[model samples]
Target chain A: MEIKQIAEELVSLVREGKNKEAKEKFYSADIISIEGNGDKVEGIAAVYEKSNAWMSQIAEVHSASVTDPLVAADHFAIGIKMDITYKNGYRAVLDEIGVYDVNDGKIVAEQFFFKS
Target chain B: MEIKQIAEELVSLVREGKNKEAKEKFYSADIISIEGNGDKVEGIAAVYEKSNAWMSQIAEVHSASVTDPLVAADHFAIGIKMDITYKNGYRAVLDEIGVYDVNDGKIVAEQFFFKS
Candidate 1:
């Protein structure tokens, strides 16, 4: 798959709340996910667990939108806006940029940046 | 200026090593620049000082490329790749995503995210 195709599909899946499918299809087995804090979760299994933990805190998703994937060689970025109410009844709109490094058509590294 | 126009020109100026010009033209007077560590420099003058401090440590810039600006309403993102040699003889390639929030055609809040 081309980098754009792979990235777009992953974003589409996530926006649809099909995160498990997105991970299984687009992530490499040794994928490394890096957060804004410079911390990383190595391996697809570990990253999946982290994603689950984040999702578990969401009580309701009000809206979600993913922008078109902007491709730059083997790297790409996507803008995300997600509005939700957390399990604790805290509601907020989360805007973020997700940058990915692709290798052999599968995402090997994914990093996210966002405002606090 | 439109958001795309503002973002593209800023990236172009920075890629050309005219960062001061970029800041003066595109950044609002009260612009807030946020780093990956969540630290921020408020006001244009403070941000300019921060930019200069970073440039002073760079012995040479080997290459720089800024991707096309991705626009989403009043928000935009640009990818940057910079190859540089520092004053201490350390050479590294820096890749980052810069996300900006623009108000009235000037960048008001800028945040950066990258891996360590």
Candidate 2:
């Protein structure tokens, strides 16, 4: 699959609540996703743990669409707008820019930032 | 200047407290910066206003380095870590991915996101 396609799929899976599958399919053994942890998550085991935390959050992402997905030779960036519903009957809107490094048909690194 | 060089310079200008010079040097008249405002700031005037707000915040970005700056034909993503020390004796650390759209030798669009 094209790198862009994979990226789309990963987000799709997560949006669909298929967090495990999404995590499994998109990440490499040396995968590094710079997340809210303030540090990088390395290796499959670590990524799985990260996925667990990410999935357990009481939230629903109403929309996840790519805006201005700029693709290069081996890298691409996808800007996304996400409407998340929290457990406290509160809703948060998050806009994110996700930068990915695809190597050997797998995502090696990803850094995501949200608007607020 | 090379696109990367321009990117570096613009960021440098801002870091050095030369916000006006940096904004003047890098942005086009129709510049659009998708900032924390949740809406796009259009035109050079709007961008300048945005810059004013950005420059007014009391903070010190201890480190701003590019991590895996993926440069494509028209887009590039830079992951930046900022250590902001507020005047109220509070520190807010932000890790952001800034995506820029350069057209006609100037920044026509930019989007920024933080880890939090």
What TM-score does each of the candidates earn?
A: 0.63, 0.48
Q: What is the TM-score of chain B in candidate 1?
A: 0.93
Local error of candidate 1 at B100, Å? Answer: 0.8
| Clash number by candidate, in order | 0, 0
lDDT of each residue in A18-49, candidate 2, tens digit only: 75786678778898787522378788898788
Candidate 1 positional error at B90, Å: 0.4
- The alpha-carbon deviation from the true structure for residue B105 of candidate 2, after best TM-score superposition, in angstroms, is 0.5
In model 2, the Cα lDDT at residue B79 comes to 56
Q: lDDT tens digits, residues B1-116, model 2?
A: 66678777776775676758977888788887885334787899987876667657766656544455545445557655657776666887665567777776787777765422
Model 1 CA deviation exceeding 4 Å by range: A1-9, A12-20, A23-68, A71-76, A80-116
Cα interface RMSD of each candidate: 4.3, 9.4
Fraction of native contacts under 8 Å reproduced by each candidate: 0.06, 0.02
lDDT of 1 by residue, B20-108 (tens): 88878888999989886678999998998998899999999999988878766677788778899999999988877777878897888
- RMSD in order of candidates: 6.0, 13.8
The runs of at least 3 residues in candidate 2 whose Cα sits more than 4 Å from the true structure, single-residue gaps closed, are: A1-24, A27-116, B11-19, B59-68
Residue pairs in candidate 2 whose N, alpha carbon or C atoms collide under 3 angstroms? none
What TM-score would candidate 2 get against the native? Answer: 0.48
Model 2 CAPRI quality:
incorrect
